[model samples]
Target: MQILINLDANHPTFPPGTLDTRSRSLMETYIKERFFDNLMYHEAVQKDFAVWLEAHQKNSQASPKGKRLEIRKIRSAAEKGLNTTTLLGEMERLHFDARNNVPDKQINFGLSHLIDTDFLARMAKQAGNPDIPITQRRGLMLFGATLMVGIRTSEWTTARLISDNPPVLPGETAAHPILVIQTAKTRKVDPEPRYLILEGFDRGALGMIEACIEMTASMTNGHLGQLVAGMRQAMLRVADSPEAFELIEHIDMRTARKVFTVESRRDKCSPEAVSAALGHTTTNNLRWYAQGDIHCERLTDIPLARATLNAVKKVRDPLADFNERKQLAGGKPLSGYPDLGTDNPNADLDNRGSASLANRLINPQGNR
Candidate 1:
């Protein structure tokens, strides 16, 4: 004897072993819209659905990974039969095995791509051009601000820039500027706003925010969502152009966060400092955005590396000088020591060596 499985009997809101006509209709409509039309939750259609999924995979033109996700959703919704549990288990195993065969993908772009000098220069140039549309220019400014500030895309939509009576200027030499963001993701019990102080190395952040405000000042109430949509459209135009922007392939707000974290680290800023800048209370929350390779092999003049080398040289030079001075002050008299500058034939050689070491210790860079 064969047992039958009632597909709609498992509806959460309806009574057990009973199917509500309205809910069944709604489910049918959802399946048609999400997967395909004429799909029935019956054992007889299982083979047909499998065949349809294969055809859909080919015709949808979606990537293999995306197709896998769609298949999983379909399996979850359609699993209702005597063999449903076994079938679902087999499907999962197949997916896992198939994924194991594919090589692990490496991150093609990271902080360097986001902060590429060429890309930033182009954005800045476009934003300042008076000939460009006001909306597009404003979008450029928004994008620049997002990149510089490392705020979430959603946060950017609700952020505000407020200054003192005079209104802070926009330049590297400008006074301190602050950006206020009404954070969306926080503990429900105690919600508070966050502030980003734009100054010092990140002084350019203020310029971007100022430009955005200036462009939108004519409107009485300009919505940040609309402004960001305009910017996204502008970026899409660049991405579609023949001579696309260098880093325009997949640049988004998430990329902005990674760029900020990696650039901060490269600038010798501690993880704690970066976390605080990103409005996180601890470094644990920062790991996701700070996954870029720390030791980049690219040939570039890393400012932090140079500063570190200089610091090491400073310490070493002082220690060398101290050791030389101590030996000279406490060692035997010049006449009693043969290695010293005494009345010996090799006195000139010893004096020359001492002079060279002293010069090296004094001028670590070897400059005259």
Candidate 2:
């Protein structure tokens, strides 16, 4: 409301503080008039939707996830003689900001390139291509497994694949395959391992995880980081476009973990269930990772509605220019100006550019 009032030309100017009662009243009246006008509001909707979408994108891009990822990279760099003090200070500030500030929570950030089914499928296809390097194929397998199970970067070495109980039990349809992951970032409070049921994924997804486990059987956790890096390069080789390449370039464990949580929530799983899958002992931390369905739907659908409405041109105010011209002429009528106020009601759309492009194109003669 305050933003709307500040944007209005006739709004009263005041110091940088709370709005006065008159300003608030004017803002309310403006909103009511805009809502009740009932005549097509395409122009206003387009303008407002553009502003809102830009702001949403900006906030999502500036999310704490980016900062945390950067902090981790810098800390890792410091091990090889990047300034340790500065890195530690930055980490501390990140923690402080997270606690004190309201970070931008993204909505409907599901099924993106970072964790899309098609992207995974393409990588899997590349894995099976004998022409591709065996090392690249191995990395792709590990990449798909990490994304599907949402394993932490550090947990790659500790993650173990355990088959369902009585692996070959006849007609055990309820039996679910398990992936055990040693929890990271527990700060020594909750270091217990978490189990993920692989029943949610299909046989193809299981193949990726199985292949990854077989390849890494002889390697230690310390070697897994380099393998993950190789996966990023493999992803680049398969990316079909520059935008896909950019998103794949920033692929990290956090992105995969977020995808897991969101996809789980999309399946109508309770918050507690999703939190447990994420290895969180409580649901308190879920807010940073995922939002409720209503918020996501509202934001994701706004642009869709805006695109459909944008085909029609803006509605012109016929009296606006005439009134301005009259005011300039000392509130007297111009000599040659025809009074548009007296024009026929049916002809109102004539000079107003109110006819939709589809209608105009279909009936060039303007009969219907």
Q: Which candidate's TM-score is highest?
A: 2
TM-score of each: 0.41, 0.49
Task: Estimate the TM-score for candidate 2.
Answer: 0.49
Lowest summed lDDT window (length 10), candidate 2: 300-309
Per residue, candidate 2 scores C-alpha lDDT tens digits across 129-222 of 8986666666666665665676665666667776645242232345567676777877777565665666655666666676666677677665
Q: How far is 13's C-alpha from truth in model 2 (Å)?
A: 29
Where does model 1 exceed 4 Å of error? 1-111, 130-132, 157-176, 201-207, 211-247, 296-368
Single out the weakest 10-residue window by summed lDDT for candidate 1: 301-310
**Number of clashing pairs per prediction, in order:** 0, 0
**Per-residue lDDT of candidate 1, residues 77-115 (tens digit):** 535545454335334433443344422112423335435
Candidate 2 deviant stretches above 4 angstroms: 1-114, 164-174, 187-192, 200-202, 291-368
